[model samples]
Target: MKLLKLTLAVALICLVSCAEKGSRDTAEKETAVTEAPAEKAFKYWTWITADPERTDDSYQEEFAKYKDNGLDAVLINTNTDPELLGRLTPLARKAGLEVHAWLMAMNRPGDSVALQHPDWYAVSREGKSCFDHRPYVDYYQWLCPTRKASRNHVLGLVEGLAKVEGVASVHLDYIRFSDIFLPIGLLPKYDLEQEEELPEFDFCYCDVCVAEFEKIHHKNPREMENPALDIEWKQFRLNKIRAVVNDAYEIAHKHGKILTAAVFPYPEMADHMVRQRWDKWDIDVVLPMIYHNFYNEEIDWIGFATKQGVQDLKYKDTELHTGVYVPEMSPSEIKEAVQLAKENGAKGVSFFDGPALTDDMLQAIKETKEGR
Candidate 1:
């Protein structure tokens, strides 16, 4: 009877222990299942370097730090380097960061390619086929977008970048006309040979572009805008840009990757400065560089302009990301701008991106999220 009692007690204890263990296991799983998703993060892009390791000596180390400090994505200008990207993909994955290829679509050849293919260059208003060295700037040349050769070169480059494994997106920058903002000076530079009486509307009136435009419109822009150019002819110049952007979209979409553009803030600035029709293209995302200081009085106009650009461009459904110069303002002020963008219906904002990312700024992003 004593042995029987002892055996029964041991069996009861084992049953209770098993039940308790099962309960603990269930509680742990429930706790884990209840954890929320990570906070949506801000994206970053670099226009300077093509190599990400050159981006920071320790790529993984820097991303781990950013992860700890809080940043969502990093876009490096590596659209030209598939082999290098091959090595960097594993590094980005290990660090838990999204990688992007930054392409200078129309802005070609800082030195090498332009020097080799001089004929591929755009012809300026003065009819200069090969651009003489500019006064202070280092950028030598840009390929004429209307040319099939130029278009193919850019498309091929993008396709190569698209093949890079682990690239989340391909970012198009300078995907427009030359951002040469001449003062529309009251008078042409005297001593300048054969200056026209009309204001120089800087642009790409390349031979190929002119031919395509004439085929579509049956008129020349110079003659119409010259009072000699009709409103329709002037508008045709803007349409050419849309054609290029749409072409790029087809290629990028076919590959199953998202296409995003870096554009100027206002609709007019986009059209005037770079001929980028932000309100037209159905890109996955559009990032307008609304550097308030650069726009002068247009500072207060940022929110309204962005909202209009988003809606007028028929991109109300598209993701909106504003590019801000982080160093120009205080964190609170930056936070207010982001709030303004969000209130005006932007999905998120991206900083111009060299700032140290102060704790206050992170808090502001946090606040922006909570307020939404």
Candidate 2:
């Protein structure tokens, strides 16, 4: 009877041990599946500037809010203030969040380098410099990409930002021409009907651009009755922007930094309105600002725009991140946006600015992180 009892106890112990081993094996397999190749983890990030946050002593507390909210990264505009960045980067790293330096590439308002060379300013079809005329927006002081000085100046700024330690990436913003054709929804605010491209908004007809176009086509674009109808003239401007972006990409790569841009949502629309052919840019990541309200689009349009960008980048090595404006979104809407972005092959979702991160939005983001 004693031997039988001992045998039964040993059998029970072996059975439990085997069960535990099987559970571990199952867990390992599950982990392997979750970490499978080509399967990227979703990245949730936000954009902020260092002016008040970095200068004040409350930056640590401000950064803590982002870390606690399950944010994978933060894109901060240091305003090219290296000392401010140097101070803020370590704080972000300590909180386990990646930090990116957001810098304006072509749109330099009151930029001393550009101010010194007035000819570097982009020109309108009506012979106006964006510097003096200040079209549409007062801060639309865009530099001409056709000039060697302009390219060199942008590259120098990129190099400075990329070399800063703890900066995981460098974000390029406002890298395109001014909105020649505002989004249909926004045209009303400007009190303009964009049924036709107006000369007042058409851009970059500077001396360098005109001379280059004439040199290639053996004709002056300014003399054309309707330059907007000319594809070659548009392509010329697109190529100039692309050249500056590619050069900046090379500079970022030289410093072993990732290059990313916040571009218009729809590639075709962007090309037509702003001459931003972002699809051709050779960068690591592209964040298309899928702000539906700005375009008078429905929530479903986010998925459509995201899918288009994903399709455009299918063959390329670039990753797509859908950028949403927080003011127009609710917590439920935020969750829906993330789901749609993932459904359309987007690797992640980003918000335009940080202040708009409300409690409900943070809750939705938390649920997203938990796979809820």
Task: Name the best candidate (by lDDT).
Answer: 2
TM-score of each: 0.74, 0.89
C-alpha RMSD values across all candidates: 10.5, 7.5
Residue 328 in model 2: shift from native, Å? 1.8
Model 2 has an lDDT value of 0.87
Top of the candidates by TM-score: 2
For model 2 the TM-score comes to 0.89
lDDT of 1: 0.64
In candidate 2 the C-alpha lDDT for residue 363 amounts to 83
Residue pairs in collision within model 2 = none
Ten residues in sequence with the least summed lDDT for candidate 1? 182-191
lDDT of each: 0.64, 0.87
